[model samples]
Target chain A: MDIKAYIDSGILELYVAGALSEKENKEVYDLMLQHPEILQEVLEIESAVIKLTSAAAQPSKTNIFSQIKEKLKFGNKEVKVVSIERTKYNWMTYTGWAAALVVGAGLLWTINQNNQLESAVTTAEIEKAYLEQQIEEAKTNLAATQNLLNVLRDREIISVPLAGQGNFATTYAKVYWDKKTNSIYLDAQGLPEAPEGKVYQVWSLTLDPLTPTSLGTIDDFNTDDNKIFAITNANESQAFGITLEPEGGSESPTMEQLYTLGVVASAP
Target chain B: MQLDTLVSQFQKKDEKAFEALYNMYSASMQGVIYNIVRDQDIAEEVMQDVFIKAWNNSASYAPEKGRFFTWILNIARNAAIDKTRSKAFKNSRKNLDAEYFVDILQTSESLEDTTDAIGIKKFVSKLAKKCIKVIELLYFKGFTQKEASEALDMPIGTIKTRNRNCIKELRTIVLE
Candidate 1:
C-alpha cells in the first residue's frame, strides 16, 4: 500500500478524531505500527488537533495539578519520602504489636464465633422462610400451567385449524373450543404481526344462514408469548371464521379479509 | 527513553515518568476537554481527573488496542462529557450548540500567548464553513463518520475525504 496516499486519504485524521469504528481504529493502529511514515502522519494530525483544541482554553489561571495533589495528600516529594521511611519503621513496630494483638483478638474471636453461630441459625431460619415463599410462588405457577394444559387437552374441546388465505396464505392458526366453559383459545402463531392500525377478529358462524357473531378482538397480539389468546364465546355455530378488521373489530366481518374457515364435522 | 519503557515505568508508579507523560499531553488534553466543556476551570478540573484516572487505571492501557495518545484522549473526552452532563453543569450552561471550537479559538484572549496561537488564529479565519462543520462534528463533538455525514448532509466518503483535506490544511498551518 502507498502509506503516504493512505495517510493522505484523511482516515488518520478521523482516527485521531476518534470518529472511526473500532475495526477501523484497530486497522489504523496496525498500519501505524507497520509503517513509520504512517505513525509520523498520525502524530502530526494528533498534534494539530491538540493545538487547535487547546487554543480554546482561557489564560493559565493556576496549576490544577497542585490542587489535585493537595486533595490526594501528596504535597511535596521530601514529605512523601520522609513519610515512606516513617511507614517502613512503623510497619515493623506495628507487626510486633499486631502479633500480641492477634492472640488477644483470637480469644475475642472465639467468643464472637459462638455468637456468630447463633446468628447463623437465625439467618438459616430466615432463609428457610424465603425459600418457603419461593416454593409457594412455584406452586401457584405450576397450578396455572396445569389449568392451561387441562383447558387445552379436555375431551369436550373442539380443535379447529384455520389455514391462511389471500395475501397471507402461508400463515396458519388453530382454535380450541371448550363448549362447557364458553371459552376458546385462538392460537395465532402463524399470523404476522398486526400492522400498526389493524387487528385480527374472530367470528362464529351458522352455515345455513351465514350468521356471524363477534367474539372479542385479540388485543395483546404482538406481546403474547405463544400468540395463543383466550376469548369468551357462547355461540351456537355450524362453523368458525376469522377476518382482519380495523384496530377495533367491525360490527360485521369484512368478507375480503376472511383468513380462515373451518366447518363443524358431523358426529360419529 | 523508549516509549514502552517510559509507559511501563509510569505503570510501576514512577511519579517522574507520570509527570513527564502529564507534561507531554496536558495541553492537548486541556484543549480537548475545553472543546467539550467550553469552560476553562471545569476543563482544567476534568483534565486533572483524567490524568488521575489514567494513573489509577494505568495497567489497563494496552498499546496494541490504540495509540497511548488516543487512549488518553478517549479518557479526557469521556470525563469532559460527563462533566457537561452533571446537574450543576447543565443547569448553569445553556444552548451549548451556539458556538463551535473555531469560534472559541478565534475569540479566546488567553490563547494569544501560545506559540501557534497566531497560526491557529489565521487558520480559523481562513477555514471554510464546510471544514468548520466537519471538524466540529468529527473532532470537537466526536461524531462518527456516519453521524458526521448525517449532520453535514454529505456522503460518508465525502466526510472522510473532506476531513482529511481539512486536517491537511490545518497541519500545513500549525506544523510549518
Candidate 2:
C-alpha cells in the first residue's frame, strides 16, 4: 500500500475530525505509528482546524483559567506567584465586573425606595385636603353662632316665643326679629320632622284684621343640622305663625294645620 | 510537551498538563460551543463544564479510539448540544436560526493579529457555502460521515473527498 495514496485518500482528515468509527480510528492509529508522513499530515490538518475554530470565538476579557481555578480552588496559593502580566489582566477584568455590579445594585434599590416614598406623599396630600374641608366647616359654624348671639343681645330686637297651637300643638318655635335689618331668625329646633311632600310655611299676620301673608317654606328643614332658619320679614308684624303646607309655600296660611303661634311683645 | 506526553500526563491527572491543554484549546472549544448555543456567556459556561468533565472522566479516554483533540472536541460538542436541550436555554432562545461558524469569524473586532486569526479570516472568507456546512457538521458539530452525507444530500464517499479538498485548500492558506 502506497503511503502517499493513503494520505491523499482523505481518510486521515476524517480521522483527525473524529468522524470515523472506532475500528477506523484504530486503523488510522496503527497507520500513523507505521508512517511519519501520515502522522505529519494528521498533525497539519488538526492544526489548521484548531486555528480555524479558535478564530470564530468572540473577544472576551474573562480569564478562563482564573475562573476555572477559582471554581476548582487550586490557584489561590499559586495566585501570588502568577506572572505580573496575568495579574494585570485579572485586575482589569475581575474588579471591573465587581464595580459595575455594585453600582447597578445601588441604583435599582434607590429607585424602588423613591417610588414607595412618592406614594406615601400622595396619600398624605389627600388626607390634608380632607382635614382642610372639615376646618373650613367649623370656622363657618363658629362665625354664624357669634352673629346670632349679637342679635339676641340687642335691646331693640323683638323676641317672639311661638307656642304650639291647634291639632298640631306638639311643635313650637322661636323668632328673633331685628327691625333694623328686617330679618327674623326663626329657631325651628322644637319643630318635628315634616312628612315627605309636606313643608313648614311661615306666615306673618295682623292679629286684629285676621289677615295672613305667606313668608316662605323651609324646603331643607329635615336635612339641615342647624334648624335655625333666617327668613326676611319686612312687614310690621303683630304675630309670627308656622303651618304645614304641601311642597312649595302656600298662598295663604292653612289655619287648621297651624303648628305654632306667637304674639310679638312690644314691637319696635 | 509532546502530544503523546501531554495526553498521557493529562490522563494521569497531572494538573500542569491539564492547564497546558486548556491554554491550547480554550478558544477553539469556546468557538465551537458558541456556535451551537449562540450565546457568549452560555458558551463560556459550557466550555468550563466540558473541561471539568474532561478532568473527571480522564480514565475513559483511549488513544486508539481517537486523537486527544478529537476526544475533547466531542465533549465540547456534546455538552453544548445538551445545554440547548435544557428548558432554561430553550426558553431564553425562542428562535435559534442555523448560523454558520463563518458568521463569528467575520466579526473583525474580536480578530487578533495571530497567524491563526489572519489565516482563518482568509480561509473562511474564501470558503464555499457547501464547504462551511460540511466542516461545521463533521468537525465543529461532530456529526458522523453518514449523518453529514445525509444532511448535505451527498454520498458517503463524496462527503469524505469534498471535506478532503476543503481542508486541503485551508491548509495551504493557513500553514503559510
Candidate 3:
C-alpha cells in the first residue's frame, strides 16, 4: 500500500472530522491498526484540530471534575464500590470504604444527639411550667399574708383568741374584728382541718346576757390554703366562739361540738 | 497515553482516562458548540451535558463507525441544536442570526488562555473568506461531503479538496 499517497489524499483529515461514510470510517480504522504511519498521521491531524478547537473554548469553571464525580454519586474522599466484579484490593478502596463508614457513623451520632437535645428541651419546658405555677401560688399567699399583717397593724381593730373549751380543749382560734368595716378575719390556722360532712361556725356573744349572734359558717374551711376565714360581724360582741356543725350550720351552735371560746377585752 | 488506549479505558468507565479525554477535546468541542449555540454560558452547559451523555452512553460508541472525537462532536452539535429549538431557548433568542465561528474568535478577548490563541487569531485573520465557510460547514458544523456540497453550491469534489487544503493551511499556522 502506498502510505504516501494515502497521507496526501486528505481522507485522514475527513475521517477524524467524521465527514466520511461508515464504510470509509471502517477502512480508516483498519488502516490505522495495520499501518503505524497512517495511525501517526491521524494522530497528528487530530492533535492539531484539538488545539484549534480548544482555542475557541471558554475558560471552564473550577472543580468541574469534583462536581461531575459528586453527581455520579462518587465521593470526594471515599471509596465507592463502582463494580462488584472487580475484586482487586487496593489502599484507595479500603480507605474509601473506611471514610464512608466513618461519615455514616458520624451522621447517625449527630441525629441521635439532636433527638436527645430535643427531648431535653421538652423536659425543661414542662419543669418551667410547673415552677411558674408554684411562683403564682406564692404571690397569692404573700398578698393574703400582707393583707392580714395590715389588719393586725390597725389600732381600732380588736383581736380575740378563742381557746379550746370543754371536750375540744386541744383546738384554738383567733378573730381580728374591725368595727369600721363590720368584718372579722378568723385565723382558723390554729384549728385542724374540718372533717367530712362538717363545717366550722363562728359566733358573737354579749357577756352579760350570754346571748349569741350567728355570724356565719366556714363552709370552705378545708379548701382554704392558709385556713384563714373572713366573717362579717355587725353586732356589739363581747366574746367569740367556734363550733363544728353538719354540712349546713344549725340555727344555734352545738354545745358538745364547741371547739373554742374567747372574751373581748374591755375598751381602753 | 495513546488515544486508542485512552478511548478503550474511557469505554470501560475509567475516570482518569475520561478526564484525560475531556482535557484533550473539550475545548475544541466547546468551540464547535459555541459556534452553533452563539451563547457562552449555554455553550458551556451544552458541553458538560455532551460529555456526561458520552460517559453514560459510552457503550454505544464503536470505533468502526467513527472516531471518538467525531462521536462526541456529533453529540455536542445535536444537543446545542436541540437547545436552540427549545421553546424557552427560542423565546429568549428570537433572532439567532447567522454568524460564523470566526466572528466569535474575532470578538472574544479570552483567547489568551489557549496556547495556539495567537496562531489561530493570526490564521483566522489571513484565512480566505471562502475557506472560513468551508471549515465552518464541513468541520465545526459537522456537515457531510454531500451536505456541504449542496449547502455551499460547490461540487462534492471541490468541497472535499477545499476542506482538505483549508485544514492543511490551519495545520501549518497552528502546529508549526
How accurate locally is residue A227 in candidate 2, as Cα lDDT from 0 to 100?
96
Full ranking by DockQ? 2, 3, 1
Q: Which one wins by TM-score: 1 or 3?
A: 3
**Model 2 CA lDDT for position B169:** 92
lDDT of 2 by residue, B61-153 (tens): 998898899999999999999999999999889676577788888875677677767777878888899899999899888999889989999
Docking class of 2: acceptable
Worst 10 residues of 1 chain A by lDDT: A75-84
**Candidate 2 has which clashing residue pairs, if any?**
none
Best by DockQ: 2
TM-score, one value per model: 0.54, 0.57, 0.55
How much does candidate 1 score in TM-score? 0.54
What lDDT tens digits, residue by residue, belong to model 1 across residues A99-120? Answer: 9899889989998999999999
Q: Which residue pairs collide in model 1, if any?
A: none
A30 Cα displacement, candidate 1 (Å)? 2.0
* Interface root mean square deviation per prediction: 1.8, 1.2, 1.7
Candidate 3 residue spans exceeding 4 A from truth: A61-63, A76-268, B113-115
Cα lDDT tens digits, model 2, A78-130, are: 63236568889999999999999998999999999899999999999998999
**Candidate 2 to native Cα RMSD, angstroms:** 18.5
Cα deviation in Å at residue B156, candidate 1? 1.8
lDDT of 1 at A146: 84
Which regions of candidate 2 fall more than 4 Å away from where they truly are?
Answer: A79-268
Give the higher-DockQ candidate: 1 or 3: 3
